[model samples]
Target: EMGHVLGIGTLWDTFGLLKDFPGPNPTFVGPGAMKEFGTLIGAGQPTPVPVANVGGAGSAGGHWRERVFGNELMSPTIGGPGNPLSRLTVASLGDLGYQVDLDAAEPYALPDPFVIAMAGGGETAPPRGVMLPTVPSSVPADRP
Candidate 1:
């Protein structure tokens, strides 16, 4: 939701935000994203590191690399104990056309040491923060 308001993820698979770069690939994430975020850490650099391509409906090939950021807030996974609000994330926000306060970015460490494992079958919790109550079968909203 916040990302929508801030213009992060796109409603379609088109990487219009990253149209400036040249490549046959249609989607980009991580280092490509970092580069777009005004960082010198992407392709053509001495050590070009790219982010993970989650490849889901809305988050795939869009969010920051999971293995690189691990428990960092922007990664697909939201582990317990919370994640860091990294400068890279803020920079991405800026790339997304948001006015970011770079000074307010949180300190982040690479290869986060505390990556919380997800549940079995590689299933993760729903992304939504609020849970809606389920209505009983055959029950109508107008009924008491």
Candidate 2:
């Protein structure tokens, strides 16, 4: 994946953006991505974006958790609402030390996990504008 090539997760430590790695809660602390993640989820304050710890080597530590981000472009797995290229990914690039235009980012938001679990039929990601920070026990609760 292009994100892998850019080291979004793979080089997190190298960039000094990762903390508490290889544990129960490895987090991505890139300021830009953190801020954007909060914005994407409507969290008024910056929130820590989670780095995946599943799917083995190529995917585990090299991509956003599939459960949390759902079909996000950088998620380990693929399948969701178009896998929209939301500002979350763009901001991550900025965190990776690349200049970017937040304005140019396409609008995207996660689906409600509760609703998704309840629906038991469709999308399982956080909903747009209402990205939740925690997944209820009933939900899969993947790393993101």
How would you encode candidate 2's per-residue C-alpha lDDT over 1-144 as one tens digit per residue? 777788777788898888876776777888888898888778898998977765567765677766577767888777556877778778888998889898888767776787646655242433359567885667566755
TM-scores of the candidates are 0.53, 0.74
Deviation in Å, model 2, residue 93 alpha carbon = 0.9
Candidate 2: list runs displaced more than 4 Å.
Answer: 115-144
Name the candidate that leads on TM-score. Answer: 2
lDDT of 1 by residue, 65-136 (tens): 565556656666665876777776676676555677866877766662343243232224336677778876
What is the lDDT, from 0 to 100, of the residue 70 in candidate 2?
70
lDDT per model, in order? 0.51, 0.75
True-vs-predicted CA distance for residue 88, candidate 2, Å:
1.3
Error in Å for residue 130 of model 2: 40
Give candidate 2's TM-score: 0.74
